[model samples]
Target: MANASARANSVTVENQDVALLKSTTVGRGPISDIAVDGDTVVTTNFGDDSIAVLDSDTLAVHGGVFAGQPTTVAVVGDRAFAAVSSASYDAIAVIDTVSGEVVKEYPLSFNVTAVVTSADGKRVYAGRSGEEGVDVAVLDVTAERVGTIYVAKAADATIDAMCLDTTGRRLYVGVTDSRSSRLITVDVETSRVRRTLEVGAPIRGLALGMEGVAYVLTSDIADGGVLYVVDLVNNKITADVAVAAAPTQLVLSADGTRAYVVDYDHVAVVDTEKRAIVAEVSVGARPSAIALGSDRLYVADYDGGVTVYTVAASTPMLYSQFASALAVPAPRELQPAV
Candidate 1:
């Protein structure tokens, strides 16, 4: 059924109100994580033991491969590392984006919940949450497992989210307990916690922007949810953007002016400078993952479907000083690994 809809040729959905570029079904349901590079789109189907791959240029499905219980994914160059953390085992499935096949796997003792890789595809950083203090597993592409980088304390702390900056030199780790949360910056070269910022709520998503500006999404029982704008350069929370009661995911636009957040049944577009929700796109099903690439918004839902949109945000494109960063970069094509 869902695959049948995707099996058919793609059709564009556009209206005066909704700028839907296209929509298609990937697999069964409940996509947990999604990653996009220059030429491909990959989603971890937590609803099943597989990951779906799609062609970025044509929006065509390239099928997928079995990845066990993949909870998170990070794409670098031609390879995509998916964190598989089922009760039976724990590993990272290295996938070839072009062939849609799992080429390799790196086994680990700790369960990886979130993963991100360097630009060169040489190193993979995985976030592990468990009884011990939260730690990041550093794995080499050629050597498998290498070492660990500790980030938070052990008193019931969990790694909620993690993001690598553009330079690939700095990492932002988000750790949360029942009542408190902290954002820790890790220096990748030395593997040390450089700075820590206290957050009032549980961190759900982490995204880095231009000029050391980080958008951290959090959820609170009393305050619902907020998109905390953190000035990493100054080490402070600049603004609190009230998004919704439970925002699950976040992605920033290529222009660095807008941030798209998944708020239950809708995707809220935020103005980074003004620190506000400027627009909300209502989805048919509850959204589980969201990503942006080359001016298109890709949203995965609980119904095993993905809707791509050519979002026309009402907010300003970028900060006046960063006007030259307006050109959107094309998706990276998966090439043969040397």
Candidate 2:
């Protein structure tokens, strides 16, 4: 059953090459992000301050939990950490999937723009974008904000997007100030800036793929948008691939060969090696986030709904493999002298 205030609908488009399997309504609010853990697909509802858990196969609602105006969610084992961005009350609601309840609320000093767990489940990295500066708060498993890594020192700067490479040693952060925008890499253990590559525009999205490579999406309404390939080892931008007008989010394929970019009107598949758009599909209305599973691509459309598109099978993604590849030895909390 759909939420009382929400409407539900579904559509399937068939074709010889690719197909749209099922397009269905998800929640009553705008979908902020989509994440898959096991067989369950979870979405954060920015409008209603709630989270929805859906069956990945049927798109059926399993349950919903109140998260206090959440923006992004990260799943670690049995708990989903949702960033609650309300001014009156800012925290991370740790919800247990089995019970569909918020078990914990970790308070934050600033507004959390994004939340992503460490490759290992031992730490949680939350991006706090404030008028003073942008910071990455490192939270322990107990949901306590123990340490903070400053990304930008300027009062007007903001952290736009962030992603971790296969190895947690590198945390790629996108920072934009009045002067310029750049991609900054920070060392996880030392919490020190390693490199900075000026991109000149707000980085809307970032995706880390195989071999220490990153795909950065930058957009300007007047200048259009571009996808930049950054070689982490070299600490430089290697290629710039043109994309749709207003690319919002990006998802890299399991094998890291393809990148799926969602814009206001279409989703473009770009071959990573070739750095070019290989295929284009028109998805009416503005599409937001995307997740791949079950030989299908699931897109969250703010106006349309949760649309499922059938795609040719590729190498299946293993959650454990990602965790292993990006996992780092747990860093201990700094202790004051006794």
Candidate 3:
């Protein structure tokens, strides 16, 4: 238990999820996807046939470029990659966050459901799904398809979600066929399957954590949803945390302590250490996507509305505590004056 002095200084953290909420609308049509980096937030507006970039703090529209039915988006540094997968268009539209212009396009032979990038924005990995099979396309920042990794061969198998580990050496693909669902981990260097685990339900989202842990969200009609904690190093599941019945996306914090899950009408906050839900935030309507920037949480509804909140993260909280503790005047509380 903390002392009374510590209690007096108990930082009033506004979730920083699980509290402190602000709602903002970006009217561009129903949002298909959302991604945030620094002070920028990008959303793919499928119905509007464009993407919208906004200031993360003010909810002000920065600028956006038009694309042909942008489905999903990812951001690395100042660049944003949107997967445009309409009937006539199948390409990766690259945009500059500051100018909000589609500077380049990488024509793709297939449609992608998930898009992720390397830490340095040098490479983009796209999850391609079709009737034939599913594979991951390795794309360089120069708007070129470098290579492809075969993820699944089952006829009509589709990749539901794709996540790259912190080290960027491992990629996890959640694929579901007509009969079963699976989580496949692949080595980036070798471009080979490292391990495959049966999930048995539709995978909604995936996020990697510290110490080789993978958090996967699976949705079931009858069973609702379950957040499975898997040990990547041991190749086993460590815990199963329940969540919403129908979920769309999952975004984990950089510290890997909390996971924000976008369910039907709310965001479920789960504590990784406790292996339980710490809070549920009401987002209203259908939440299509979610992203995290620093301690800020961005939840985008299918209707194109986004809500922002400041969630508690390990690094920021530690710094906040230390800074506060050090600001004590004259060391009155100092023990032994040592």
Candidate 4:
């Protein structure tokens, strides 16, 4: 049983020809989302109802927590919040980084799809795809459920992905529909829809930039894929970039000058300023999520592994390597930043 569980957690990739950094698998399930803070990597295990905490520098499994069917994770200071979804348990699991134990669970009306923490580390905002209404729930880390904002027209809307600006005052949610899609921005304080930008497709992934610029990924399940860049200040589509088949996730660089996208079998890089495809690299099968570190991009593949790419140099190169390692740790220790 332990070997089977380990195999289920391991991820294997093809030879990338270059010296690749040994990839590490930290949990026993599909990694739906990943977030990084210094040497810590927080992952949402969609298949296991848990969050796997990993040591970024060594790629070692530190610890994790049974945070329900965690779909997303966000960290601020010594507190980590996970958006958990399940019929039996739908809530946000809050973990004190110093102890790694679940200090509290904020219940929700619907299944949680994404979660983001405030810059000040005082509040957590969660997006839910409810049966009756699509809404955003705000929780006070020190207190309990203090407020919630529901989107009426977005009641039946499916919010799969989200991102916040530097200030954490505004939230951008990606609404995916069968016929069309839209981007909904909400004011956290009032819990009201500040604006809804209608883009003409199914938007599954979202990324926010510095000057109110938003990047939206539209999935073309039948054909290839397309990326829509929206000017939030002006509320219009700025540019559209095409990508590989079935694009699933998107991430913007720290400088907000480039966008990285993951598709079924390839990763696309776009120049945000020029709004053009700059490079494309072949990766694992069915890449699900991506996270940006100081100079590298980490991709989680559905085949049970992760691929790390070096993006710092002028020409993007496949650095280290890949491996099949899996062993998600439980959340127990929360180390306060020094």
Candidate 5:
């Protein structure tokens, strides 16, 4: 078993080659979502139900806190909110970054699959997976209270992925199933569904861009996957770009010109404006999630570990800018509330 402070094994690939800078081992369990603040990297270890805080530059374990089956996490200022699930119950554990201790735990009825905080860190939105389709759980960080919001009403479909708009006033949710998928938009203040667009394919991940544009990723077991660009203003799908098989997640570049996609065994760099695949980088067996820093891309692998990739300076963009404008962390499960 791996401990919280265990040393990480580092590996380096060429700078322009695949964007890989180093790979770090966070003990021996499955890793989920990751969040980055100035010099700290926070990760959730699902297998151990613990949170590991690492030195961003050295990738060394700095501190950790044990939460029960933590599946996702979001950071705001000096705090981190982690969604944890146990056999009998589910909760969100609040951790104080300065002390590395769990300060509070907000109980929930369903398992949380996705979590994101407002830019000011005043509010948090958690997505839950269940048959009832009660997708979103709104949390007031200052008040320590929570409320529920339903993105999808059907009993069969669940929330697959989530991201907040640039203003943080609107939230985009992907509701998907084997047979169909839909994009649901919600007004943050009222916790009400604003618009529901029927996106035909099965959604795997989601990302947003300029002028109310949303990039939706859908996978077909027999035919690989596709990236769809939807114009929210017009409420229609405008473009479709083909990608590799099993595209798990999407992260837009700071300028909104490129999108980095992580699939089963590789990461595909897509030129958003061109609607084409520009680069493909090989990775571990099961790359579950990804997080973008100022100049790096952090990939969480279930079997291999966490790999840090350098974002070429020539790209002329930062992940944090892109993350701040759209989304940062990836989805945790197939039917995600986030």
Candidate 6:
């Protein structure tokens, strides 16, 4: 009977293809960011000022909370941190993922553009950019504002996107300059600028990969676009690959072997080791953000809708079982615990 059970399990797994996973509309509005933690998928809606929580295994919208023009969202343990824009509240709202309620809101001196949590999930770094100045505020979740790092030279720079390395010791900030885009590396503990590398054109999105490697998507929004590979150790551009027109966002795979770039109306896969284009998947319409799960790639398109792609070494297939499995019953009441 044990052997028969093992055989049946193998057959069930064989029939489960990654491609079978359908991309469901977990929430409305333009998704600014999508983060997956265990079985939960949290998406920031820039259009509706809310954060939608979906079950990764079922693709069902478990619940959502009004987060106020949330431009970026990051999950560390049970807490979900959202960077609300100045147009809304100019603050970072903390939501409890388990209860789907706003537990705290940290008001910023300026517009908060991005928020990233530390590796150990003890602290959060919020980036504020506007007429006031470009600064990164460090928040101790257990306490309050412990310190603030001001990018004096970047006062005129528009801080757009930010990402941290695996160690959480280093942070890469994407700043838009008058003529080009600058990738600035900051020491998280010291909160000081370590290095600045310039990309010829303005960057719309940036992503950091393993081993101190950074990828920048140059979006001139007029002429064309390009992708620059930067080596953090040497603080230089190792390679530059020209991409499709108006590339918006860049996402790296889990292994850091490849990078997925969203252009005007398509998604291009780049081989990071070789620094070359490997596969160009036509997504149609403008793609907003790209996220990668265990073996699937999720693309949030501007108009065409979200698309999920199956990625694997052998016999790649999209699985939709997770989407349907996400329909857990909502709680009777969602209220602030504190």
Q: Is candidate 1 or candidate 2 better by TM-score?
A: 2
Query: What's the residue-level lDDT of 85 in candidate 3?
Result: 69
TM, every model: 0.86, 0.87, 0.86, 0.81, 0.85, 0.80
Model 4 segments more than 4 A misplaced: 1-19, 282-285, 313-338
Error of 1 at 201 (Å): 0.6
* Model 6 CA RMSD to the hidden true structure, in angstroms: 10.7
On lDDT, who's better, 2 or 3? 3
Each model's lDDT: 0.76, 0.73, 0.76, 0.67, 0.74, 0.67
| CA RMSD, predictions in order | 6.7, 4.1, 13.2, 9.2, 6.0, 10.7
Supply every candidate's count of residue pairs whose N, Cα or C atoms clash at under 3 angstroms.
4, 1, 3, 25, 3, 18
Candidate 2 C-alpha error for residue 198, in Å: 1.1
Question: Model 6, 14: alpha-carbon shift in Å?
Answer: 23
Indicate which candidate wins on TM-score.
Answer: 2
Stretches of candidate 6 above 4 Å error? 1-20, 86-88, 221-223, 282-285, 303-305, 313-338
Model 1 whole-model lDDT (C-alpha atoms): 0.76
Write down the TM-score for model 5.
0.85
Model 1 clash pairs are 38-331, 38-332, 39-331, 39-332
**119-206 per-residue lDDT for model 2 (tens digits):** 5656777888776889887777744435777777877787777887655667788888888899998888788787888989878888
Q: Please, what are the lDDT tens digits per residue for candidate 4 over residues 211-267? A: 667888887656467878789998899888776578878877766677888777667
